[model samples]
Each structure stands twice: as C-alpha cells, then as structure tokens.
Target: MAHRSASGSDRSPHPGRSLAGQLQHLDALRRAMARRHSLNPADMRLLWLLSDDRARTFREISEELNLEQSTVNRQVNSAARANLVQISDDQPARLVLATKEGIAAFDQDVDRSLNGYRQALERMGTEHTAEFNALLAEFIEAYRDIVQPDEEP
Candidate 1:
C-alpha cells in the first residue's frame, strides 16, 4: 500500500513529532503565564508549591521538581528577597513557606492561568474533558517511564 502526499510528494510525519509539538505548546503556555504574571517558571513553581502548603527543605523541592538543588536554592533565595517566600530558621531544619503576598500572587496567577484551562474544560463538557485529561495523564506517565526507565516499575 502506498500513501500520497498533498503536494504529490512522498512525505511522512517524523517520529515523536506529535510529542514535540505538544511540548512546544506546553512551553508556550508556560511562557504566556509567566508574561501575564510577571514571574518565571521557577518562581511560579516555587509559589505554587508553597501555596499548596507543602513546606519542604531545599533537597525535597529539588527532588520533587527534578531541578538541581542549587537552582532551587537560588530561586528560594530570590523569592525570599522578593517577599514571596519566608525562611523559617527557627525550625530544626530551615523551611520555606509562601508568605501572604506570595499566596496572593499565586492565587491571582492560578485564577488567570489554571482557571482559563478550567473554563476550556467546561466548554468541552465534563465527560469529554475527563476523558481527555485521563488520556493526557496516561501519555505523561508513559513519557516519564520512557525518559526515566530506572524510576519506572
């Protein structure tokens, strides 16, 4: 069986093209969110993590975000300087927590970014959106397994 191309040329989509396209879209969304919030991905992630009440040490954040400890530490320092995060040295181990301002900022960004997605889901209908989300989750899990086989079952 032979396939014809639109321009009468034998052309095939490249393997992993779809995944790359999806990643590009995700990156674009992240950049748009950053621009809208005036914060970078690292800053936003830190705020989001802290907003979730997941107070953790630098090491824990590094592992959870799959970012280098040094990079995470630097962002934490920057956030602290910006009054977006507070360092509690009174604790046995220093903990990072989102300050009131950080929470407020994060909430605004969430409403702007995440809520937009929520609205899109609502427009898509519950059942269709649920199925789409489920499939996206499966694809992400499979990608993780492929990228980090040692961490997979």
Candidate 2:
C-alpha cells in the first residue's frame, strides 16, 4: 500500500526522484572519495567527526551516526590500527581522538571534496547555487518536521 501524506494526497511530499537522486549522488561521491583517500565510508565519517579536536567515546559516535555499537567499535579499532586515532585508557570508557596524521588526512580530504563542490558551484553560478542551497535546507527542515512532528525547531 502506498503511503499518504497528512493532506490526504497520494503523492509523497518527499518524492523519490529528489531524495533518491541526492542519496545516490552522495553514495557515489563517498565511493569516489574513499577510492581517492584510501578510506572506507565508515572511516571517513569517523575521521570527519573526530577532526574537530574533541575527544569522544564510542557511545557518542555510535549515537551520533546511528550505528551499532559493535560497528563503531570495529571502525574505531581499524582507525586505531591505522594510527589515525588514539584510544585513551580511561577506566570505564575509552575516549577517542584523531591523531595528527588523521587530522592532516581529514584536512586534505576536505579540501579535495570542497574543491569538487566549488567547481560544480562555479559551473552552476553563485546565485543559482545559493538559491539551491537555501531551497535544499528548507526542504530538509520541512521533511524533518513531517517525519518528527514533535521535533523542536
């Protein structure tokens, strides 16, 4: 059965064409980034999260990424093995922070990714890109409200 919106419309407010295309583009981007950086998507996400110089527990990462504890643990372990992250010896929970090398890698990856985006934006022109970004943000906010009606703005 097809899902109907609150307005009793058969059409979904969040159409698959827009959402799926965005997701597909993101996945492809991630794949290309992973190949270029020699890091898996999970590791990429972990590195990105830890790039801010803040220490985080595995639980925090798991919750923030909506990933399973075991999966987070595996990713953390892999990162540690790669010397990209350091795990503290705290009693109950081990705090994780990115190593200098990890930070460097993250910065390089970000530069490359941003350059790609900048090139695309340049092709699209500044005004149109700005308008698209604003509209995308608005769409996301509206969709979030629809999904979680009790969510605070």
Candidate 3:
C-alpha cells in the first residue's frame, strides 16, 4: 500500500530505499572510515564529543551517546590508556576531559570527513543537498517520535 503525505500525494513509505539497507550502508561507511583512520568509531565519537575542552562524567557520555554505562566506562578507560583523555578527581565524580592529542586527532578526522562531504555536496549541488538535509532531519524527528514517544523534550 502506498503512503499518503501531508500534501495528499501517494508515495512509498521509504521511497526506493529500505531503512535497514540504509542503516547497513551507513554502518559500513562508518566502519570503513574508522579503519582508514586506525580508530574505532565509538572511540572517535567519544573523542569528538569531548573535543571542545568541556569536561563530562561517564554518565553524561553514556547519555549523550545512548550507550551502556559499561561500554562507556570501557571506552573511557581505553582512551585514558591511549593518553587521548584524562580522568580528573572532581569531588564525587570523575570528569573526563580530552587531552591535547585527542583534540588534534578529532580535528584531523573531522577535516578528512568534511573534505569528503564537501566533494559529495559539490557533486549533488546546493539545492539537492539542502533538500536532502531537510528530509534527513524530518526522518530523524519522525523516527525519534516513534522510538521514544514519552521522552521529554
């Protein structure tokens, strides 16, 4: 059955793409990028999150990344061992802060990633890129609503 949009146009719910396929493709891309940089994607994400010089607790990182506490703890410990981050004894909580090396790595990865994105955007052109971004945002919002209907704004 075709789904109808707000504009009363009939369309396939997922257009020509399947959500599972798209997710798999995205994961593959992430894995390839991580491998190219010799970094775990999760580790890279954590480093990116802490790149702004802001200190965060393990719990905060877990919540921000929607990851398990144990997973966050393990990643944090790994990063500390790599000297990518430091754990400070801040009163009752240990705050995680990105080290200078971590920030540099994050910046370098971001630059590489953005260079690819820039080339892709140039190929796609401004109008199509804008439309794709808007659609992606809409899809994200819709998925969020379905996944966490009772979540607080």
Worst 10 residues of 3 by lDDT: 30-39
Against the unseen true structure, what C-alpha lDDT does each candidate score? Answer: 0.84, 0.86, 0.86
Instruction: Show where candidate 1 strays beyond 4 Å.
Output: 1-11
Order of models, best lDDT first? 2, 3, 1
| Runs in model 2 lying further than 4 Å from the true structure | 1-26
lDDT by residue for model 1 over 1-153, one digit each (tens)? 344577887766766777799889989986776688756677788987777777888877888888998898899999999999998898787899889988888788778888878888999999999999999999889989888989845
- Rank all candidate structures by their TM-score, best first, as comma-separated numbers: 2, 3, 1
Best by TM-score: 2
Per-residue CA lDDT of model 3 for 5-70, tens digit only, reads 999999877754577888899888866766667456777889988977899999999999999999
Candidate 2 lDDT, 1-153, residue by residue in tens: 466887987864555667789889989886786688656667779998998889999999999889999999999999999988999987488899999988887778778778888898899998999998999899889889999899787
Evaluated at residue 20, the lDDT of candidate 3 is 81
Better of 2 and 3 by TM-score: 2
Error (Å) of candidate 2 at residue 73 is 1.6
lDDT assessment of candidate 1: 0.84
**Model 3 error, position 16 (Å):** 7.6
